[model samples]
Target chain A: MIEITEVKQYPFIEGKNLTLCAPNKDNLNLYASWDNHPDARKYARNVFPTTAGDLKKYLERGQERAPREIGFEIWHKADCKPIGFIGFNFVNWADRMGNIGLNIGDPSYWKKDLGMEATYLILEYAFNELNLFKITADMYEMNTPSWKICEKVGMKRELTYMKQAYVKGNYVDTYQYCLFKEDWEKQRQKFEFK
Target chain B: MSEEKEEKKELVCIPFIEGENVALAPTNIDHIQLYAKWNNDPRARHYARNMIPHTTEDLKKWFEPRGGLTEHVGFEIWHKKDKVPIGTCGFGRINWIDRNANIYMNIGEPEYWNKNLGTEASHLLIDYGFKELNFFKIYAGVFEPNIRSWSVAEKDGFILEGIEEKAIYVDGKYVGARRYRLFKEDWLNRKAKK
Candidate 1:
């Protein structure tokens, strides 16, 4: 006879290979590892060192719904583990717009198209479910892969700020990508999204 | 009448920055009703793009200090002569590492509009951001139809950074939002020339 345990995940939005779920405190250790990882932190815009205690506090606060921010944890359907995070950070309800943020924490999952799928899922939820008019994303010019994922999701490069951000002792340009709901509605059909 | 008097007695204005015509003061929790009035007033809230109705309970949460490093700093606009709070203004979404923040203001009292108070407030707040707060830059966004706001931004020497197309929805139509930026170096140079 054998005993087995299951990882409980509360999936809020399901995707092809991934699902966005409510962040669980049981995964704090995994979240801490990702927050401290150099490559992940660079693209995630974590300027200061993040502690486990900080992550705990964040999880505790996440229990309540915040008016301006809505976040979710990305659970890899096949792997049975949380691999990333994605959400709308600045939701302007009156203007019907939001700023999107996504972080693929697991290094093993990088460049696997999981992030791209997650982006599409979130966009559908934003426009179709939430009725957001516009969605915007910002990224460092050096982070080509991140911006590429945004472009594949029908986002356009709206503006470039010269030397707007300082990262690792060097100033870098920041790019803002925007997509309107009406335009996404027209393009989502091409992605086979009903 | 007695209850109103009790509420008036609780109102306290603590000036943080003083200008000739208006002084920047910490927001008084006792004046949540007044702020709610301004937030819901049709004529006053039109240019501010406040579409949602705000209740006193909703505003109390906003006024409550979220302890620790705050990303926002709001102040009540106090008229010197009349000794009354006419509106509110401050910096929101402050990026400490990047040394930048978004500045916004609303003259809630319609009678106070076009009195150069906004110009005075902008000058005082901009000076405080650069000199006292050691901020590198400040950003502002004005809806395309808001000529008065852009005029004040221009008078304060803010340069047009970019225009976000069809970003805001108003009156069943979409409108662009004009972005303006002011750098500390440019402000200093302008002052030297003056």
Candidate 2:
């Protein structure tokens, strides 16, 4: 069994103007609010509207898991406001791999390259602290904007299955992308973390 | 303005077979070392279908047959402005069956990996494939781990065919392979779209 722990405190991972940190109950409302956004629901697995109570229960369950996947709330370090969430899920220790998912729930932050910065920080934690060998991510083929983030951050598209999953009564293809530890190291060197 | 005009020269149409910026010409004995370095690079090897390290002798033997092909061709990918050979891109494994061939390239110099040189060279090669070689289709195989290659293929308008599982073994693991093809008809369509 893989032991999971909350990163209770973290130094601000500054990249451009964005910072990332572990989510607390105070930010649970932000998660709830983002969960209710229509655009967020379009690609999210659990599309149903979420409340603060639901988020609390979700985080609690996450904490109870053997291989605890942590979610971190993204912030603008300069302004100290919640922007979105970025973290790992479905972590498998034996394989030393995990799924990385992120969303900039705030439209104000979209297309500002904040997603790339937030992802770079989370990947640093996954590769450096967690010692994960590979990290995988997925997005619907039509979600070009999200996949562009994958491209900008050096994640490679590994697979695209036709009619792989049914979403909202329509069968849609999802592009599976991945970044290995070595590749991540190369990207780390290129990422401007200031 | 007159001073700037004095520095400019007419662009020369160099032979496609003479690769520009590369260190060793395609048929040179030293090319074995070049191939070894490219295959050993984690990023390059990832898309190379998990190629194992090749001894100098192994590389020599591999190139022996390829170098003998009447159409055995290679070109150095140069920095357009500086004209430094950062990589090599060209055809290998020319098969007459179905009138197709494999396209290969290596930006052994890591600094140029994300730059658009590979794409530009590939476009030039595809044009050569159609107008010069008179080929019906051109194909290439990339490992599932190499996402940059897929993006390049997509940008080049190559159609994804299918996956070949456990097709390659390297570093004690079986890596899956992806096949992509660009047909003459599709190429024409793409050209029209452009």
Candidate 3:
């Protein structure tokens, strides 16, 4: 006799080919690997390697939500693996606002619309489920893909922290973008993707 | 007996600098509610980066024991005519190393806005920054959406430094930020000319 069991796919919030779920212990190695990758590190602010021990601590931090913070793992529906990360490191529940941070660990997933889709999914979750008022994302000026993805997903540029970040070798400016729930609602309608 | 107590309350609200309509006073614990109320007001909070909703308790953490937490001392603005607190303004912080600081201001009462109180208070703060604290450089980062704010900074002789593109999120939009700086030498020269 043969037994058959269906494979389970976990997705807290569903997007087309992307699903956002909580970071899992099983994917700790992937997080560490991505944070340490040379190509990935160039875009990411993490100068130090995310070792297994450090990642375990980081995973634990995700569990503690307070005045407001949420973490997510970007799961590729087709590949069934978390190819990226996204989170609100600064969440003001009372103010209905948060500052979002994201990174795609797998370089191959870059420019595949995965980041854009994940952002749309999170924006929906942030405003509808969480009842947030506004969401913001800030990136180094050199991180063109980041700001572009944010702009494509309805975030409008709002602020420039001049020479704020020390990146690679010299000081670089950081661009900040944001969208309100109502604005996102209007903008999301204009974006239809496969 | 009640009248005497009321008089004492009025006495405590006295201003440090008596402007034409508004006067500046060192912020006191009793003024926490006023600060919290204004900060909670979306219109004023939007420009000041007071995104998080502030409760009286939160205000206490910031305004109370104002002596210890930081060098970012605040002042209460009292409307001379109404004898009521109109807003708060002061140095955001002092960089002892750099001999400079950022200017802070907020007109909680929407009615009080554009009444030239900001300009008057800015003049006062700039005087304090240059003459009192001996700061070499006093600067402010005005959000691009806030034209009136930058205009006042300009009127006070704060030169346009450099713009950081997309620096802050407010009113459902990402707004660029302009840095304005005023050197003590310029202020001294202007004073000498006068």
User: Which one wins on DockQ?
Assistant: 1
TM-score of 2: 0.48
Clashing pairs in 1: none
lDDT (Cα, tens digit) per residue for candidate 2, span B1-194: 87434433321224334333322223344444555666677866655543456577775664555333355467656555554445667777564433567887777678887877677778878888887887777777887777787779878998786675444455667566787878787898879987
Judge the docking of candidate 2 as incorrect, acceptable, medium or high.
Answer: incorrect
Per lDDT, the best of the predicted structures is 1
TM-score of chain B of each: 0.94, 0.73, 0.87
Which runs in model 1 stand beyond 4 Å of their true positions? Answer: A1-7, A10-14, A60-68, A77-80, A192-194, B1-15, B29-33, B55-63
Give the TM-score comparing model 1 with the true structure, all chains together.
0.86
Error of 3 at A60 (Å): 6.4
Error of 2 at A128 (Å): 1.7
Overlapping backbone residue pairs in candidate 3 total: 10
Candidate 3 off by > 4 Å? A1-10, A25-67, A78-80, A89-99, A106-112, A124-136, A154-171, A177-194, B1-56, B63-87, B90-103, B107-151, B157-194
Write down the lDDT that model 3 would get: 0.77
lDDT by residue for model 2 (A1-194), tens = 11114333344555668777667675666677787878765676654568889889876774554465768778777655777888886786645678888988877778888887888888888899889888888888887888998898888887775544456777576787888888888657887776
A57-152, model 1: which lDDT tens digit per residue? 876663344368887899988888889889987898878899999989878899988888889989999998888889999999999988998899
DockQ of 3: 0.10
Candidate 3 docking class = incorrect
Model 3, residue A94: what's the lDDT? 48
Pick the winner on lDDT between candidates 1 and 2.
Answer: 1
TM-score of each: 0.86, 0.48, 0.57
